[model samples]
Target chain A: MRYPVAPPTLADVAERAGVSRQTVSNAINNPDLLRADTLARVQEAIEELGYSPNRAARNLRTRSSHLIGLKFQPAQEGTANAAMDRFVHSLVETAGGAGYHILLFAVGEDEDHLRGYDDLLRATAVDAFIVTDTYLGNPQAAWLRQRRAPFVSFGRPWDDDAADHPWVDVDGAAGVDLATTHLLDRGHQRIAWIGWHKDSRIGEDRRSGWTRAMHGRNLSTTGLASRTEDTVSSGHDAAAVLLDEAQPSAFVCASDTLAMGVLHTLRDRGLTPGHDVSVIGFDDSQVAQVINPGLTSVRQPLEEVAVEIVRALEGLLSTPAVVSPGVLLTPTLAVRETG
Target chain B: MRYPVAPPTLADVAERAGVSRQTVSNAINNPDLLRADTLARVQEAIEELGYSPNRAARNLRTRSSHLIGLKFQPAQEGTANAAMDRFVHSLVETAGGAGYHILLFAVGEDEDHLRGYDDLLRATAVDAFIVTDTYLGNPQAAWLRQRRAPFVSFGRPWDDDAADHPWVDVDGAAGVDLATTHLLDRGHQRIAWIGWHKDSRIGEDRRSGWTRAMHGRNLSTTGLASRTEDTVSSGHDAAAVLLDEAQPSAFVCASDTLAMGVLHTLRDRGLTPGHDVSVIGFDDSQVAQVINPGLTSVRQPLEEVAVEIVRALEGLLSTPAVVSPGVLLTPTLAVRETG
Candidate 1:
């Protein structure tokens, strides 16, 4: 009838079960290696005494922390990228279901970021890391490999020749290809491409998708290619420039921000979006749906991607030595009102 | 010069310094208590041998993880609450500055959630927790207090009498007042209210601010109130219903999502937002600026609140058994094109 106020310890459970401390630990962590009868006795004792294994001690016993590291970036002011939200949400849900948690830490700029990673590694803070937004000569990739740390990036290694790491990236070229193909199927001859002017693997991959789609069929994309920054204002200016230079019937935008910008330009000229000039956007953001004319966009299978990333990371954690190849998931086109 | 492939250890440092292992440890972790000569000898040995303290060993010695836990919930599909984004961003930035890292975990449902919290606590996975979006009988508050766990909520304790925990909440009422006063100053006599239909401390607090402001000036809010779910569709529906029946000249929405919804309805009816009716929203999200006509909103001082929350929690962590009181922060008005 009387219950203990203090938390039940492993020693208490071991005493109740008449087993050694090592046996108790094995029952909790490596039950398969023990005899069925011994396992049953330890389990019964643990339940009867309401004993929960201490984390620090459990960590020492198993040499594992079921914790992954994620670099949490605060969104820049006045920016809303739903793709980032989707990826993190799906990744968290997937990882959590697998009994893993993410430790979020601020990654300092440049060399400081590598130092942060080193400290986390030295502190035994995480079992592995999920690096996003990777670029050429990314120090994280180099550091993780140098330390032989278990990790699976959510983006491709920019320098493929130099870097060898497990990763998962939604095929940007495939996503834009879907958008361009869909617009072409809608009987649009001149399909323009609107994207950022930056030099990025992702940006280049998306532009190439459009170029390949056009060149493959000889659809005459001349005077229809325009570039701008990732801002709505930039998209608007790019739209204006492209419109002045060429007469394109449709456009494939790199981001929802740019898509919304194109819509802004159309509205300013008192022109109907779909009827005057069809538009397809990448990243099926919530803004794509809320704008005056719904945006037909390419929806990255983020949930599937999350599941894949976790599965890959789990493989690394479980085996530790296997260098799994990279994963690439293709996005699907979401046909809404715009196109 | 040859370097050892294995990392330098405490034994190596102690052997090189010709001092006791405990003296070497004190040099790395706690140098104040050691004699200056002993500390200097150990430091020189460490520098010479390139010794780095092992994290697992350090953890066992200090019994602190320097890890904070945060529950990351993905916004429901089609829902975008930038307040969530702002709060996490500022909180992480502030905590990181203080040498604390956040462990982002997915909260399970009901009993599972409590179990997750308990597991994290037992595992020493996090030093403390920052509980947000608290409600009456929030199991986290109850469970943490019952176990004497260290945690500080980002929302006020809902059950005022029973739950006395350290918390910090933005004055929702004050936010509404800022929005209402701004509208009133724009020569609007009939200022309507749009908010959630649910019974929540936050919802009630926001509505009461408007009521107090109107009542203080002997102005009637009669036929000027509408409520809906915190979504754009609901906001649009509620706006339609209110505009049809209330005939108010201006509206104060509980959230930017709702304000955006109202704008959608107004545009549909061929009504210019500011000309026909002024509108104000809360949270001052990026949506406020991106909309056709910018929205004037009451912005929660999230960065300040983040600092305050961390400051209060840091105080509790540094000195145990001292119950720290809750903190409250004010909101400011951001004027734009809407009002």
Candidate 2:
């Protein structure tokens, strides 16, 4: 027997099964719509022909694309926050295993961030969205909610406390607390906190952890807090000022990027890290791992977060959709040479 | 004066335009199939109703998805190579401007690399693919070719010299030459080369640059070349062995990851990176940028590569499709503190 030059199509399977094209389509897309005997014949024919249904047609028949829309932002040039790399990897793997793919679109710096989401929604291009930007007062979650769009955010709705959206977020305060307490347990007081500006809700949350830990021990955090942009240079400058003014023996930074800056400041001053002072960073980034002295950092449970996000998506897309409350996971410290 | 709770559908547009649902579908998916006046009437109704055509229906009508499928691999842990972050960002932006989005899928370690491609093709989930894996003897390109799939790769087809496929790649040899020559110009004779093992086609190509540059100056590279895995620890070990055995005054690494290792080894041996021993690395990664004193390395024009790939795709998808030959872009040296 000669091999067919072209792969078998749905019509080929229908003809082999002695059924109409609609019967084969229903058998693949909505088996419940077909009788058991007809479905069995179609299945055998499909297997014999090695037929794979067209996704577009299947999407129309099922009213689902099994594609999740995600807006991919440009890489921040100087920041060492590679959290998205690991998170995206995990999300893709988790979603793929669940028969879903991530459809990524780019938005311009000048364009409104919601424009991409609106366009995708208008075209019905994806079944749902995986929103990553849940920053303070960010309108994406609320906007999607207003349009009754199904979504799962990687962060909590910081601006709207009453917003009941499906979300999965790492507990930043808990993570920073773990770091600060670790340093305190190592006999360090005057633990300085280096974080983002006060306007940043996430930064404030992380800073509160350090303050709470310090206050619990009756240590004044009056001049040990420095807030600035989340960058290596800012981190470096903050650490320098804190060292000169407050002379803190330990530092708990908001991110690994900031931690790298603290490391730089220590190196410049000829002070040995973890000896003269201790440093702990958040987000166990690749930089934290491969730096000269391994960085002690708060590693977010990103893999678990991805699994949770996919779980939420599945629940949202089910026939009787279930909208679960936000999931908040705690991060663990990855101790190394620094702390 | 009142707002409609539900969005407009195809049937609504057809009714407003006094046409059948098929006419409105044809107007959106294949305007060429409709009479000019009838198409204009349907367009007016659609604009008035603010109707966004369903992507699935459009796909079925046009036999296209306006999507490019890309397999996103898990991020390599412990490696400083963040090229994908930059490349993916660029590809998404470039493709988005051209009215196409990226559909990302994940593959299991034990599964064939082509399984994802085959599944996507069989399902007609994407219009084409952007292949990134062009490693030596990799079966992906050959398998895709055998299936007569439309694709553009990010690396040259190294295993098959006669293979003609649209690809955009950085000139690895040229990048290494630039790095080597910079060191040579700085009065470095014994320039050791630290690169990946011989099995990697890209690594071998990069090593050739060092060999060619050394031979061009009539300098013996007999004991100065060392090969290992592309990792910081491997680079450290190679640098240590080279310093003890050959005592090279300068070093050129295949990647920033390896170059970082050399810096660690130098620090361990009481040698300043740029002062006592010159060093250069490829892929001017974020690590190279933020590392102390900065790292002098080669920067691939990944944005340009993305643009070229999109250009090739546009040409391939145009009416009566045009296929272009491989495009090779040259990389430039990012002069910083190291070399």
Question: Top model by TM-score, which number?
Answer: 2
- TM-score, chain A, candidate 1: 0.85
Local error of candidate 1 at B185, Å?
0.3
Off by over 4 Å in 2: A1-51, B1-50
lDDT of 1 by residue, B40-113 (tens): 99999987754566555555555667778888776555544666666777887789789888777776555466
Lowest lDDT sum, 10 consecutive residues, model 2 chain A, at: A1-10
List where candidate 1 sits over 4 angstroms from the true fold.
A1-51, A108-111, B1-51, B108-111
- What's chain A's TM-score in each predicted model? 0.85, 0.88
RMSD of each: 5.6, 5.0
Worst 10 residues of 1 chain A by lDDT: A1-10
lDDT of candidate 2 at residue A173, scale 0 to 100? 93
Error of 2 at B131 (Å): 1.2
Interface C-alpha RMSD, model 1: 6.3
Per-residue C-alpha lDDT of model 2 across residues B23-81, encoded as one tens digit per residue:
99899889999999999999999877657877888888877788898988645878778
Query: True interface contacts reproduced by each model, as a fraction?
Result: 0.29, 0.51
**TM-scores for candidates 1 onward, in order:** 0.86, 0.90
